[model samples]
Target chain A: MSSPAQQSAGKPVAFVSAQALRARMHDAVNDPHLRQSFRGAMDFLMAKRAAQFPDQGELDSLRSLSESIRQYSLSKLPDLLEQLEANLTRNGVQVHWAETPEEANAIMLGIAQRHAARLIVKGKSMVSEEIEFNHAMEAAGVGALESDMGEYIVQLAGEKPSHIIMPAIHQTKQQIAKLFAEHIPGVDYTDNVDALIQIGRRVLREKFEVADIGLSGVNFAVAETGTLCLVENEGNGRMCTTVPKVHIAITGIEKVVEKLEHVAPLFSILTRSATGQAVSTYFNMISGPRRGEDKDGPEEVHLVLLDNGRSQAYADEQLRKTLQCIRCGACMNHCPVYTRIGGHAYGTTYPGPIGKIISPHMMGLEQTHLLPTASSLCGACGEVCPVKIPIPELLIRLRGEANSAPHANPAMVGQGAAYDPKISLLWKLWARLYARPATYRAFTWLATRFRALTPTQQSGWTAARTPLKPASRRLRDMVKDRR
Target chain B: MSSPSHGANTPRTYPSRPQAVYFYGTCLVDMFVPEAGMDAITLLEREGIRVIFPDNQTCCGQPAFTSGFPDEARRVVEAQLDLFPGNHPIVVPSGSCAGMIRWHWEKVCAGDPALKARAEAISARTYELAEFLLHVLGFNRKDEGPATTVTLHTSCSARREMGTHLVGRELLARLGNVTLAHHDHESECCGFGGTFSLKHPDVSTAMVSDKVASLKATGASQLVTADCGCMLNITQRAAREDQDAGRACASLPGEHLATFLLRRTGGSPCGDQK
Candidate 1:
C-alpha cells in the first residue's frame, strides 16, 4: 500500500505483499477491458476443451489413465530418475541434477561456458524461465533468446508469461502491435495475427541459425527409452532442439515417466486439454544427440533435472498429488480467479491453480501462502485437470500447512508461515461454541432476537452487497412452532 | 475410471425411501434462510416421510474445516456424529453442507478408527435434499401456482462435489406451471464460498456481479438457488445492483429451490417472508 508497484494491464508487474495482491486484484476486477478480454478468452478455451471431450466416458478413462501413469511413475520416482540418468548416459546424453534454482542456473551456465556458447536459442521451456535462465545466462555474458512466438513477445516487452500455454494470452493484438512497432526493428504497426507471428518468426529464425546452443523443455521424459518427448503446435521447439550444435533440455524431476507407452495417454490428454488439439502439430522425440549416421541434428545433448522443492512436496502422501500435473494449463483456463485477475497477479513462474498449489513448495509458504486462498474452492481446476491432480484437495492441504503450527521436524520449508495466534484462538472459540448444542441454540436465539440491531457493515461482505441479517425466527423455533 | 473431475458422471444408486430421515438444517439456513428449511421439511412430510429435526445438529463443520483449522472442525464434526445414531438417512438442504457430511467427513475423520467408521456410515446414508426427493422419494408435484419464469443457480459444491446440479432441474421438470429459463454459465459459482466472500471481497463481488447479471439477462422474474450461502450473496448483490441502477431493490426476488418448489406445489410457506 505504501509504494504501489508499476501496474500494467490492471495487474502489478510483481507482487510485493499480501495487501498488494488484493490491491492488484481490486484493479483487475475493475479493469473492464482486461476483464472482457480474459472473460472472452477463457470462454473460448472452456468451449474448446468441452468440445474435445464430447464423451464423458472417454474423458474419464483417459484422465484415469494419465493419473495412474503419473502416480505410478512418481511412486518409484527415485528409481526411475536413477534409471533415466543411466539410460540417457548410455544413449550418449549427459544428465545433470540440480536441487535449487541457483544450482540449476549454475549448471546451465557451466554447460554454456563449456561450449563457449555466446548465444542460446530457447523454445517454450517453463523450467528455464522458472530458474530465470535467460537472466542468468545474460549476466554471465552469454546471450540467451526465446524462439517461441508468445515467449518472444513477452520477452521483448520485458514481462513474464501471463499464462502457461499461451504466454502472451493477457495481451491484446493491439498491445502486441504497439510493442512490436516500438521495439522490433523496421516493423510497422499491425494488428494482424498472422503478420505479427511472421515478424516474430523472422527475427527468431536468425537467432536459431547463429546460436551456439539450443534449449528446450521436455513434455515427458521417458525412462524406458531414454527419450525426451516435446509436444508443440509450432515448429519453434523442433528448431531449438535440433538446429544448434548443442541441445540442452531442462524440466522438473516430476516430468519423468517409467515407460515409453506411458507417454501416449498423457500426450493425448495434455493436447486435448491444453489446446483442443487431437495432437500437436509436432510431437518431436529426441532419444539422444545426432546418431553416428544421422542426417541433421545437434552434436551433443544434455538434460538438467531440477528439484527446486519438488522433493518437499513428494515427502508427504497427500502433497505428492501436486506433482501429477502434466503442465496442460487447463486448470488455469477453467479457474474463476484466473479468468478475473489474470496470471501476473500471482507473480510466480507458474500462475493460477497450479501455481497456488506448487508455488508453496518452490518459494515456501512464507511467500506463496496467499496464492492458495485466492481461489473460491470451486473445484473447476480439479474438475478439468487432464491428469486428475486433485487441485482443490491439495489447495486445502496447503492452506492447512500455511496456518497450522509447525511442529518439530516439519516436512516443508517455512511451514506455519501464515499462522496467527489471534486467528487460531478465534477458530477455537467458534469450534467450542458450535460443538455444544445448547450454546449454538442460545446463540442463534439471541441473534434472531436482535436481528434488527445486526450491523450492516459486516466486514468486507458489505463492500458490494447488502448486509446479511438473521431471520426473526430460527429454523429450530420454526419447526417447534409448526409442531 | 475413477477421476476427480468425473465424480459427477459416476452413477450412484439410491437407498430405499425410509419412513424417517434426520434433517440437517445448516447454520446458514438455521439463522438466515430458515424459510428454505421449513419448505424442505414440508415437502418431505407431504411425501409421507417423517422428518426428524435433530436439535443437537448445529453444523457440518465446513467453515472451520476449509479455513485451515482441522482440529476445530473435527471437534465440531465429532459432536454431530452422536446426533444421528441409526441408519435412517440424513437429509441436508444445502449441497455444500451435504457434500461436507457425505464426502468429506471420512477424510476429516481420518485419524481415528472409530470416528472413521462412523463417518463412513453417515456419509453412505447422507443425501442432499433435492437428490433425496428425486432419487429416493420419486417426488412428483403438480404446479398449482401462477406462471413465472425462474432461473436456478447452484453452488460449486452442489454442481461439482455433490453432482446435484441436475436434481433441481429434474424436480422442477414435474412443475408444469413454472417455466425454467436458462442462464449463461449456470454452473459457475455465485462467489459465496463461505469465508471466501469475506476474505477477498472485491474478487467475490466481481464474480457475484457477473452471476447476477447473467441471471437477470435471462429476464427471469425470480431466482432459485440450491444453497443459501449463494442465495445470501446473489440476492444481496442483485438487490444492491438494482439499487445502484436506480430501480427498486429485490426486483428479481430470490428464493431457495425448496421454497420455490413448495410454493409452486400450493404449499404455503410457514415463515414470514422478509
Candidate 2:
C-alpha cells in the first residue's frame, strides 16, 4: 500500500484561463471511450429518474413544497444557526465556525491533536473533499482513510471523486480489480464486482476497529432537535461515526433547517432524484455524544460549520438560489453538455451543472468564469432540480456579471474578472445596428443583394457543418412586394 | 403562465382566430431561411387570416440576452416592442424566438424600468406559430400530396419554456398521410444555443454530432422542426454532397415544420412532394 502522505493525494484545480479550459474540453471530447461511457451512463440515469417520477402531479407538488422549505429555511438562516448552536451545546456537542478552508482545516487538526489521533476514518463526504481534509491530516503526520467503498476506490487511485454520489463511477471494474490486486494483500486480479467489493470491505473493516477518530458529512442539520442527518445506502457511514471514540462532522452553513419536519419532504425527493431510490439503507441521525449508558456512540462529538463563500452567494438575491441545492446529481445526469464532457474535465470539487453555478462562489470568477459559459442554456439542470434552482437563468446572469464594468459595490466575489473591452464594444455596436429598424433593414438588404460574397468558411460554425448563407430576399422584402 | 409552469398539462387557454395576426419573422428566417417564414404565412392566410408582416421587425434580443449582454438585448427587444402596437395576436414562426418573446421579453427588460410594462403586455399576446395553428386556427391538414415519414426536433427552449414539443407533435399527428418517425433523446438539445456554438465550437460540434447521429438513425427521409436555429444547426451537420445527387444533395433535408405542414396541406411548390 502507499504511504500515508502519498495516500491523501487530492488536488484542487488550478486557476486556468478560458483557453486552458477549452483545451481540456477539447481533449475530453476527442476521447471516444470517455464520450461513449458518459453517454450510456447518463442515458441510464435519465431513464431511471424518469421511471421514478411516473406521476407528474405528485412530483410537481413535492418539488414545490421542497422549494418553499429550502427558501424559507435560508431566509431565517442566522436565527436557525444560533438555535442549532445553543441546542447542540446543551447536548454536550462542541460547535466551531470556519470562514475559509484554512480555518476549517486548522480546527479539524486541532481536534485531532487534542485526542492524539493516529488514524481517522471517513464516511463519503464531498464537503471534506471541498476542504481537502485528507491532505491536511496526512500533512500533520496522521493517516486518514475513506471507509465508503466508492471513496476507497478513488482514494486508492489518488484521484478526486468524479461524481459526488458515485465517487468511482468513472472507473471500470477491470481497472478496480487491478487496483485491489496491487494495493491489498493476497488479492488476485478478478473483474468480478462482488469479489472486488469484498476485498475493499475487508481492508476498511480493519481500519474501522483501530481508527482513533471518525469523520462524516451532514445532509441536514435540524435546529429544533439539534440533530445531524446523514443519508447513505452503505452502512459505512454508521460505522465511521459510531466505532471511534471521537466523531467530527462538517457541512456547509446552508444545510440547516428550522424544524425536523422539513427534512421529510427534502429526503423523500432527494433520494428519488439522486439515484432513483425511494429510500437509502441508512439515515443516521446523531444528536450528540454517548452519555447515560449509551454504549455504542462516540464519547465526544464535534460539528464544523463551513462558510467558504456561501455567504457571498447568499448576499445577492438572484445568486442565493445556488445554495438551494440538496446535492442531488440529477442535473449532471440530465445536462447535455455534461453528458459529452463528463465530470473530470470540469476540474472543480463539484462537477456538471450544479458545479458551474456554485464553483464561482467558492473559487472566484477569475478562476471559474469559463464554467458558466460552458453550458448551452438547455435548462435541463433547472428542469430536473428538485428545488427548482433556475440554473440556466443564473448562468445568463453570471455571464452578465462577468462581462459588465465593475461597480464599486459588486455582488459577486470575482465580478468583472472576464470583462474584455473589445467584446463589450462589439456587442454595443451590434446593439446599435439591431435596435435601429432602418439600419438593420439596410444592412440585411445589402447582404442579400451581394449574397454571392458570403464566405464558405465562417469561424467555428463551418468546422462540422456547411456555411450559412443569406437568402436572395429578406422576409420583410418578400412580404412587402407581395401584391 | 409562469416560465416554470410550461409543462405539457398546464391547461392553456388560447384566443379565437382573429381577422388578422402580426407575423414576427425571426432573424434566422429573415436572412437564411425565408422560405419557412413564407410557407408559415401561406398556411395562416389559407385559413382566412390576414398576415401583417411588420416592416421594422428584426432579431429578438435572445442572442445578446444569453450572451450576458443584457443592456444590448434590452435595447433590441425594446425596439421590437414598439412594432406590434395592436391588440391582435402576434404569431412567431420560430419556437425559440416565440418562447423568448413570450417568456423572456419582460426578463431582458428588467434593466429598463420604463419598458418593463410594455414588454410584459407584448409577451402576454405572443404565441408560437404551431401552437397558434393548433389552438386558434384549428388547422386540419389534408395531406394533399403523397405519404412520407419525417422526424421532428424540438429545441430545448420550446420543450421546457413553452411545451411546444407536444404542440409540434400534435400538429404532425393532425396530418392524415404523414408518419412522424421517433428519434432517440428527442427532448435533448441540438446544440444551436445561439452564441454557444460560436464560443465553444468543439463542444458544440460534438453535441450536434450526437444529435445528428440520433436524427439520422430515425431513418426518416425528411427531418422537420419548429425552431429555425435547430433547423440551421441540424441541416448543416446533415448536409452531405452526393456526386449522383448533383446540386440537390442535401442527403437528409432538415426543414421547418411550417414548410413541411404547408407542403402536406396546401401542396408543395414542386407539386406532389415527398
Candidate 3:
C-alpha cells in the first residue's frame, strides 16, 4: 500500500501542481455559492449558444468550414507569420517578436519607456495575464488600468480572471457591488448588473482620457491585408486602440491568418460561441498608425507577436491543433468539469478544456500534466468547439505523451512526473496475465472465491460508494455449469 | 448511422436479421452484473437470433486505453480480437465497451496493417445492444409490462461515439408502458470515466451527485442506463448515500437497458431478479 504522500506524488501535477489545484477544487466544490454561480451562468450561456444555431445543418456546415480555415492557416503558419510581419511593416506598423513571456513583457516595457508613458489603458487580454503584464508594469512604476468591466473588477480585487471570456464569472453581482463600494471612492453598493457596469464605465472612461499608451489583444491578425481585428461587447477595446497616442497589440503567433476573409467565419462563430451574442458591439480593426489624414487614431501603432511556447506546439503535428482555438469559451461553458468547480481550480491563465490541452505546451508537462487528467474524457468540449478542434483526442494524446518514458522523445518539452516504473510494470504484469486463458481463469476463480475478502475501505472508490466486490461465481464457470 | 471506411476497404453490411451474433459480454457485465449479459442474450434469443458466447473473452481494453496506456490496451485488445475470428455480428451489452471495439480498436492498432485490418473488420460488425435491436434486427416487440416511470443515463461514449442514446430512447419508446421522464442536463457525463472516478473521486462524486439529483428530480423510481460502468457508479453512489442517511440499501436502483428490456418485454423471468 502506498502512503498518502506517495499516492499524491504518483498523480500528475499542474503549473500550480495537483496538490494546490485539488485543494482549491475542494474548497470550490464545497462552496455552494461558487457551484451555483457557475452552474447558472454556464447553463445560461449554453442555452444562448444553442439558440443561436437553431439549424443543425448550418451549424455543422459552418463548423466544418471554420475547421478547414484553421487547419489551412496552421499548415502555413511560418510563411503566414513572415507575410504578416512584412505586410504590417509595409503599412507603417512596427512589428516586434518575442520568443518568451519575459521577452514579450520586456519588449512592451521598452516601448512604453521609450514613449515615456506613465498610465496605460488596457483591453481584456488573456495573453497579458499569462505574462503577468500588470505586475511587470507596476514594478516599472507604470500604472496599467483594466478598461473591460469584468477585468476591472478582478483587477481591483487583486484577483486573476477565473473564466477566460467571462473574466469575473466566479464573482456574484452582490460581491462586485461590495467590491466596488469598498474599493471605489464615494460609491454605494448596488446589486444591479447595469448599475455596476455604469459605475465601472464611469471609472474606466477617465483612465482612457489620461492614459498615454493603449494596450490591447488581437482576435485575428490578417496576413493578406495587414489588419489586426479586435472583438468586444464593451467599447473599451476601441478606446484602448484609438484614444491614446500610441497603441500596442500583443498576441500569440498562432493568431495570424492567411487572409481577411477567413476572419469572417471565425468571428461569426466566435461571438456566438462566446456569450452567445450574434455580434459584438465593437469590431475594431487596426491596420496602421494614424496617417496625416486620419481623424481619430493612435499616432503610433505597434504589433508584438509573442511565441511564448507556441512555437513548441507548432513543432508537433498533433499538438498544433491547440493553436486552432479562437479564444471562444464555448468549450468551458459547456464543460461539466468547468461548470462544477468553476475556472479558478485550473490554476492557469486559460481554464477548462482549452486550458487543459494548451497549458502543457506553455508551462511544460512537469507543471501542467494534471490539467489534462482533470477531465473525464466526456468529449463535450470537442463537440461544441466551433473550429472543431479534437480536444478530447488531444487530451488523450497529451496523457500518452506525459506518461511516455523518459528520453522516449528527447525533443519534447517536459519530463512527465507521472511516469512511474512501478506502475508501468504493474500494467505489463496485468496484460501478461490476461494474455492467456489459464492465468485469466485462475485469477477470476480466486477473485470470486475470496469475494468477501474485498476491502471495505477502498480509497476514493468506497468514499461515497459501496465497495465493488467480485461475484460469487465467474461468468465462464456459470456458462460451463449451464452447458 | 453506418460505419465509415478507414482505408481502401468498403463498408461491410450485416443482415437485417442475423442468424447468429457473437455476444461480447463485456468484462463489467461478466463479473459485476452477469444478469445484464444473460438478459442481453435472452433478448437476442427471443428474436430468433442465435447467441454465441466465447468464454475466453475478458475485456476490450478501454480501461487501459483511456488511462494513457495504449500499448497495454493494444495487447489486451489483440487477445480479444483473436478470440472472435468469424464474420458474425459482434453485439455488446454496453455502449462504452462496444464503442471501444468499434471506433478505437483500429486506432490502437494503427501501425500494423494486418492487425489494423482485423480491428476494422471486427469494428465494422460491432454494435451496441440497443443499436443492434433497433437498427439491425428492427425488433418491434409490443410492450407487455405494467407502467413504470424511469429516466435513462447515457454514457459519454455511447452518446458521442455510437449515438446509442437515441437508439435507447427509441427502443424505450416502443415499450408503450414505460414512461420516459425528461431530466435536465441529461446529456452530461455521469463521471464514471473508468479510472477517472478513482483518480479524481471528489470531482467524480460531485458530478454523480448532480446526476443523481437530476435523476431524482424527474420523480422516477428507477433509472435506466445502457453502460455498466455508469450503472455501477450511479447505483453504488446512491447506495452509499442511502447508507450515510441510515436508510435502506440501494435507494435508487439503476438497471442496465438490457435488463429493463428483457423484463419489460417478457423475454425471461430470471433477468428480473436482479
Candidate 4:
C-alpha cells in the first residue's frame, strides 16, 4: 500500500490501482468469511429489491420514468432550486447555498457558531465526506460524531468508506473487533457481528444526548411540499435529525426532486438497486421540524444546498445525467472490480461505479486523478444503473478531464505538464494500426519476415506467446493469386 | 418476421428445406476466426437455415465508435444498412458486435437523417447467436458428452451489453456431460476494450492477468468465453503462466465458445473434421 505521503504528493496509489485491486480480490475474495458475508448481504438486498416491485416488468418502466424525471430535474435545475429554497424557507427552515466546498464549510461553521455547537452528531452523507466536513468541523472546534454504523467504523479506523451504501464494507469483523478493542470502552474484543452493533449503539446514544446540533445528509428534498426524505438501515439518521435542538441537512443541489410523488418510485429502484433491499429499514421524511402533534422532532431545521462543481458537471452534455444517481450503490455491489478490493482501495468518499464518476467532480481532478482510470470501461455500471447514467462513458470522460488537471500526474521528477498530447497521439495511432486487420497483418509480416533483425525472446509479449510466425499464406496473397 | 421464400431466395439443393437466415458474422470471426463463422453457418445449415452473407457489410462500427470516432464510424453504419436492407433477423456470433448493431447503431446514427431509417431497420433484426438459438430456434442442449469440468467466463460485453450470460448458459447446457463452474467476478471486464489493450497495454495486461487468475481459482480445466478478444487475452495469459510454471499450468487451458461446443457436439473443427 502506498503511504499517505505518496497520496498527498499526488503520486498514484498502487493499492488503489484497478489491476492490483482486482488481483488482490481474486485471492482474498475466496476466503469463506468474505464470500459468505458477500453472499448473505447481496442475497438479502436482492430479495428486498425484488419484493419491492410487485411485478418484474415494472423495472424497465421505472427505469425509463426515473431517467425522464432526472432529465427534467437537470434541465430545470435553476427553477427547482428557487422553488426548493422558497418552500423550505416557508416551512420555517433556513436554506443556504454554497457554490464551493470552502463556502459550504464556512456556512456549516456559521450554523455551529449560532448554536454554540460543541459536539455535533451526524448521519451518513457522501456529500459530507465530499467536503471532508468532519475535519473542517474539528478544526473549527466542533467535535463531530458519526452515528451511522459503517461511517462510525471507518471513522475510528481513519479511512474512507470502501463502499458507498455499506460504508464499512471493506473492514472484516476481525478488523472491527480490533478497532473496537482499541477505541471503544469496556468491550472484550470479539468478532461477533451483534456485539459490534451493540458497542456502536451505546457509543452513539451518548453523543445524541450531548449533541446541540444534528447534521444529516439529505437523500432527496421534495420541492413541491418542502419534504426531505432520508433512507437508512441503522436508524441513526432519524436520531441525529430529531434528538438535537437544531437540525441541519446538507446535500448536493441535484438531490432535489420536483415533487413528493417522484420520491416513491425512485426510492423503489434506489433501495433495490443499492442493496437489493425492497425497502430501507427506515425511510424518514421531515417537513420542516416540530409540528403541533409531533411528539419527537427537532424544534428548528436548516438545509444547506451545495453546488460545489455540480453546476459544472450539469453543464457538460455527457456528464449531467450523473446527477440522476440516488446513491443506491447498486453499481458498486454488482461491480466486479469493487466487490473484490472493497471500497477503501478507492481512497475517496464515494467508492465503486458512482465514485469513479463523482469523485473527480467533487474533489477536483488534482486530488482524484486516479479514480477515473480505475475502470475497465466494460459498461457493466450502465447495465445495472436504475436511472441509466451510462457510468462507463462518464468514467472515460473523467479520465480525459483528469489529464488536463495540473496535479493529475506527479511532477515528472521536477516541474512540467502532467500529460502531453503528442505522446498520447502516437499511442492512439499505434492502437488504431493494431485494431485494423489489414494494417496489423502487413506490420506483422514485416516484423516476422525479418525475425532475426527483431529482438529475440523479449519478456512481455514476445517471450510469452509466439508472434504470428509469418502466415505461410497471407489472405491478400491468396486472393491476388486466385484473381 | 420475413419468411424464407419472401425475398431473393437462391436456394441450393443440399437435400434439405433451407430455413432462411441472415449472417451477421462479427468483425472478430470475420477477420480472425473465420472458422467460427463457417462453423456457425454450417451448424445453422445442418438445422435447415439458409445463411445469407451480405457481402456489402463493412464493420459493426463498434471499434471506431467506441474509440470516440463516431463521426468516422457513421460511414461503416451506412455500409451495414446497405448490406442488410430490412428485417431478416440477422444472427451474429460475437456478443459485443451484436450488441453494437442491435442497440447502439440507431442511437449513433440518429444524428444523420439519411442513415437514421436504415440504422433503425437493422437494430430491430440483429441478434446474438445464443439468443437466436434458444429464443428463435428453441434449440436446447440435451445430449451427454465426455464428462469434463469447465468454467464459463462471462465476457463483460456479453453479460452487460448483449445479455448473453443466461442465454449462453442455456445453449451450453445442451452439451452432454459438461458442468459449467462460475468464477466469483464473472461480470468484470477482461480488459479487451478494443484498442484499449494496445493503447493502455499495461492496464489491459493487468486486467487480463486478474481474469486468468480468477478463472484458475474455479478449479476448472477449461475457461470458455464467447468473445474472441477475451479468448485471446485469457489464452495469452494462460500460455504466459504455463511458460512460467512449466508443468504446473498444464492442467488449465482456454477455449472459445465455437471450439468448446464443436468438440462436445462430436463435430471436429473444419481444419480437423475433413
What level of docking quality does candidate 4 show? incorrect
lDDT of 2 by residue, A1-483 (tens): 553335444442222443377888999999998888888888888888888899998998888899999999999999999999999998888999999988999999999999999899999999998888888888787888988888888888877788888888888888899888887768799999988888788888888999999999999999998999999988999998899999999999999998999999999899999988888899999999999888688999999999999999998888998999999899999989888888888888898999989989998888888889998898888888999899998999899989998878888877998999999999999999999999999999999999999988888788777888999888887777664
Winner by DockQ: 1
lDDT values, one for every candidate: 0.87, 0.86, 0.84, 0.69
Query: What docking class should model 1 receive?
Result: medium
Candidate 1 clashing pairs? none
Name the better of 2 and 3 by lDDT: 2
In candidate 4, what are the lDDT values of residues A310-370, reduced to their tens digit?
Answer: 8767877777878888888877766655654556556666777888787666656655655
Stretches of candidate 1 off by over 4 Å are A1-19, B1-8, B272-274
Predicted candidate 4 versus true structure: per-residue lDDT over B99-171, tens digit per residue: 6786677766778766787776776667777667667776654554678878887677667666667877877
Q: Estimate each model's TM-score.
A: 0.97, 0.97, 0.95, 0.80
Estimate, for each residue in B185-255, the C-alpha lDDT of model 1 and write its tens digit.
88787887888889999899999999988998999888988889888899898888787888865767888
Candidate 2, lDDT over the whole model: 0.86
Please write out the lDDT profile of model 1 over residues A305-370, one tens digit for every residue. Answer: 999999999999989999999899999999888899888777788988998898889988887787
User: DockQ score of candidate 4?
Assistant: 0.19
Task: Give the candidates in order of lDDT, highest first.
Answer: 1, 2, 3, 4
Candidate 2, superposed: residue stretches over 4 Å from native: A1-5, A8-19, B5-9, B240-248, B269-274
